[model samples]
Target chain A: MCVLCGGFVVQEHWTEGRGSTGAASVTVGGGASRERQRDRRDRTAMANRILACYGLKLEDWNGSKYIVRDVKGSSEIVHDLGALWPAVEKLIKKTADPLDPALIGRLQQQQQQQQSGRP
Target chain B: MAANVKIPVIILSGFLGSGKTSLLTRALKQPQLANSAIIVNEFGRMGLDHHLLSRVEERTLLVGGGCVCCSMREDLVNACMELLEDMQRGAKPRVDRIIVETTGLADPSPIWFTVLRHPVLQHHFHVESVLVTVDAVNGMLHLDSHDESIKQISAADRVIVTKTDIADGEEIERLRRRIGQLNPAAEVELTDSEDTKSARFFADNPDSVRSPRTRCAMAAADGGREGRSAEDGRNGSGGHTDATHSVSIRFDRPLDWHAFGLWLSMLLHARGTDILRVKGLLDLGGEGPVSLNGVQHIIHPPEHLDGWPDGRRTSTIVFIMKKVQPQQVTSSLLAFQHMLGAVPYVLETDLQFPY
Candidate 1:
């Protein structure tokens, strides 16, 4: 347990919904669509940051792997959003067990506001 | 270009008033260095050396942020990338190698570590050698009085005694012995004619062969892993921030880039003096890992690389600063994460950002 942040491990919403249902319903509770969307937004943001550093424009490609052409030679740096998004989602789920629906809903609202350039 | 051609980096280091610039001026005249790229860091008010060396006015990369490796390592790397890109774009004589000249009062560790730790650099370029020059006229006095001078000697792969034409033979011999005692592995070369050949200096070493200095560096990296956690954040011995120290910041998930950009700009602006260098592999929302770097006030845009060399989830940012609190820097960074609703491990509040 990290003394810095209280030992409180915030469970993933899916994990909490099921974990509370006892042993019989443990594996049945999958999370709402809200948590998954948050994961995707976070992953996409990560991708954009990576592309920006490489001198590549995000609007250049239609959301697929691209090649990073440098002066030395042209090397390929592929960004497969399909593969990365899921992994980030999995990591979010594992670190926090028994996730909060209210937090997920707030995060979704934040995401929409971000997409709309509101806040 | 098909079969991977490794990039070669040549380090030029020396003490104050030493013949480092003089030697570089001499080396640039050589036919071998005709197509090479030079990275220079500035510490003094006047930057006459850049003007002096660019007699050809071809392509001279002025790394004015701070000390290379410590404060300007990322800038050095970015400069190298730009140079490489220029070479590919049919700009010059098609140069592949790079020569980095450190400031007179600079430590060689950060530069050395930058070369060692960079993933792209390791794949593209290998550190050919660390060549340090000692001034024959005031060499002994500088070595005796300056800790920076001692470090320059200690980390040398090759030691060149300059201005031998004017100095007494006995005095030159004494200086040679002192350098040898500090580091016996480095081969000592004496030159007064300024006719040192670039081919002769960096030729045999190549990237394949491992020299004594490289071996020591490898040993230091391995044996010093324990100290890395502590030293990574500690400030350096220099009263002015040393660029070699790095601050590592890890994120649990991808961060909000806008917040990150704001935080970075704020950090760089507030502590520009202390922050000599910044570089990291960032997890862009949906993208893999993007590498970001900044030197002094200039964050050289950004470079979206091919992919992580390995599947490392955690995002790491290293800051080489002087006389700054690592905890404060870390907390400031954490505040950015907290704004994004990410909880980070608050390592230590008073952790030294020593390099």
Candidate 2:
């Protein structure tokens, strides 16, 4: 059990390609504070792109957990990026498929926009 | 099992009648694997294979009546947990390795899931390798017919071709070629009765899997080229209707581990079944590159290598896939890698949901 968030999260989450762990519980250990925070923020940002596909928004909560909320106000407290997808699915009732033509198109377009200095 | 202690697990899979039992029996007799336990899983109402290898006695547990991949997945987990419990309680002798011999029809992915996904099992056990057996006589026919056989071959770290005495030389050659086309990274060998004993294979490898060597072999298959599909010169891709191809991608810049993990996790979540295996030597701007490997949805924790094998700063990743579009992987990975050092201040709201 993690003293930080009360669950066995992360490290395990980082290895999970299945993208489904459960509930809200993240623990930060090792590494310098700045580097760790930056990784967390980057992870959250990458997740926002996928979650937005399902009308869900993700935010880092106190650096220990994440808050995932849908446009409809239905929300879930996710433990880490690994646990975010299922929470997004539960909130929007659909698979947040990365290979979905729609999602890929958006990610590609977003990359293009970022490249072209477009907001 | 303690929190940090890990045990090695070898998943032995083969098509029905591929001589898995005979090989396992011979393996148990060897000194290298003598202190090993077996968990034999068989499909159907009863399992008789466990009785055949009764030499291991209490160490051999029979998980019967259902496939390890589907129906009796929990039973497989229980069997593993029970092995740990038995050893801990002194009911059974402690062993160095656990070999889960799946029924011929079982897919190794779910068995991997049963170990990796279980909270206790994940911490207590680590899958060392997937060893698949292919009998030379019908192996080609099975690969030409069965998807399970194809998956077993694709997931293999080592392939043991059995019954060489009965199988003609030419037939064995074809089987070997097909196995290569299916998985170029797999180390294929004949069950020559001396090779397994000599190499000290599954039982002896207590170290992490050398995915770098596997990647090097995969790259070498394409003549050491990058971005080319390894699908050419292969007839029909080992009975798969679609081209089961491998694509090698190179990155000139360093990879941000966090971002790379995120992209891969998302990709695996949706397309894991189609994407069979991935091996990469990632350049994290460190003195050495870290190795990343995945079989379907289960990506093993990355291991850092001493240094680049080729001494190149450019990171190399190879993907061996079945039915998945290479563009799906390439485009997404490149897009994510672009943000390695760029400020991620841009929010999701900034990009229009074009889809």
Candidate 3:
């Protein structure tokens, strides 16, 4: 399991045994299964969990190749396993807009005033 | 740009306390490297004070006669650009070679990308080699614990094992073997040896190194399926859950270039971060032999060698990766080749088999 993200890390070994060509296959996680239904379920579950964590939703899509619409109505494709993290990060950034310096300073002053009053 | 006049730059990288500075100090003293410019990155803890004891200027020092040492103030590209400008303005001494010594925990790929891919730098500078200093006494422990050390060893063209005087002979041998496993193409030299010369660090011909076959042969003899974990048997050291591992694949016949390229592109796209280094000598049907070198996601344009390094004309590729299994790489290549209908050889019984 990845500690940073609460995703289950799977190590699936797919071996291609041929006569003495001596090839090896190793994959970390994602899209290794040949069963389309299972692959779809796994990818959707992972994506939905990531989206929920960032308070977003998948509005629409055309199969797994492309994401037609998200909560923001953006048309984008989740190309491969590697693209998942970047997509999540983008969604998080969009949701949690950077706080202004003045606003941050105001919040800090208010907290200090409240603490002083309690004392 | 004048032809054959680019300044050769060597990137000296190692983990903290790996004796990179000591090696540089010795190398700078050599008469052959007198006119060399050394760009040393200042470590937060050490602060380059030892190197700055004899300063010619604020951030620059003249060490060992004519060698100029400057502290890297900003990004490597800017530092190198400034050095070049200084030379042009006659502000700094003229130099034939430049050595960029990275911080202990630095990743060499970015520096390499800067040198090789930058438009201006590429035109004026050529990568001479990547020289890594590995401490013989604590090298194995460091490799087991630190990802930086693994990347340092993996990306090296030449590895200088220092502090061998204090390390156990058997332990040193073990470390040497492990280093070979991590990077088979690199030439390993002991710094403690009397015959070891500073000039040898600068002397490297990518073509002269032994073929991947010689290294892969050992793995192939073991049937290539068994994976050896670097963490086994060592106690009290940091765990190697994310340690780097190596895989060597050999093809008996020529490969389809287009098919191989497609597979490699897809693979890098998917697992580029995990892949530290990929070096291969390829046999492409009638096109002859070519060398493929890659660090992380960046694949340098392939170089065509005059002939095979060894008599063996087979295609062999060695991949050093972190948290990646060797079996997955080999099978994926074979699968891709099979899909493209470009499988090199076929077995008599299994018509669909891809070899």
Best TM-score goes to which candidate? 2
**lDDT computed for candidate 3:** 0.56
Better of 1 and 2 by TM-score: 2
- The residue pairs found clashing in candidate 2 are A25-A79
True contacts kept of each: 0.00, 0.20, 0.00
- Which tens-of-lDDT digit does each residue in A13-112 have in candidate 2? 6432222212234557654576668777877886776566567788999988889998877778977655665566667777666557777677667777
TM-score, B chain alone, candidates in order: 0.50, 0.76, 0.76
Kindly give the number of clashing pairs for every candidate.
50, 1, 9
Worst 10 residues of 3 chain B by lDDT: B344-353
Candidate 1: segments with Cα more than 4 A from true spot? A1-119, B1-4, B43-72, B90-93, B194-199, B202-355
Stretches of candidate 3 off by over 4 Å are A1-119, B1-4, B43-74, B88-94, B193-196, B203-238, B241-243, B286-288, B339-355
lDDT of 1 by residue, A1-54 (tens): 011111122212111111110112223345545554454355445444433323
What does candidate 2's lDDT look like per residue over B64-172, in tens digits? 2122221226666677788888888999777777787878887776666566656677777877678899998888888878888888887787788988888889888
Candidate 2 — which residues are off by over 4 angstroms?
A1-11, A15-35, A49-56, A70-74, A90-94, A101-105, B1-5, B42-72, B91-93, B168-170, B193-199, B205-239, B310-314, B340-355
Docking class of 1: incorrect
Candidate 1, B149: how far from true, in Å?
Answer: 0.5
Better of 2 and 3 by lDDT: 2
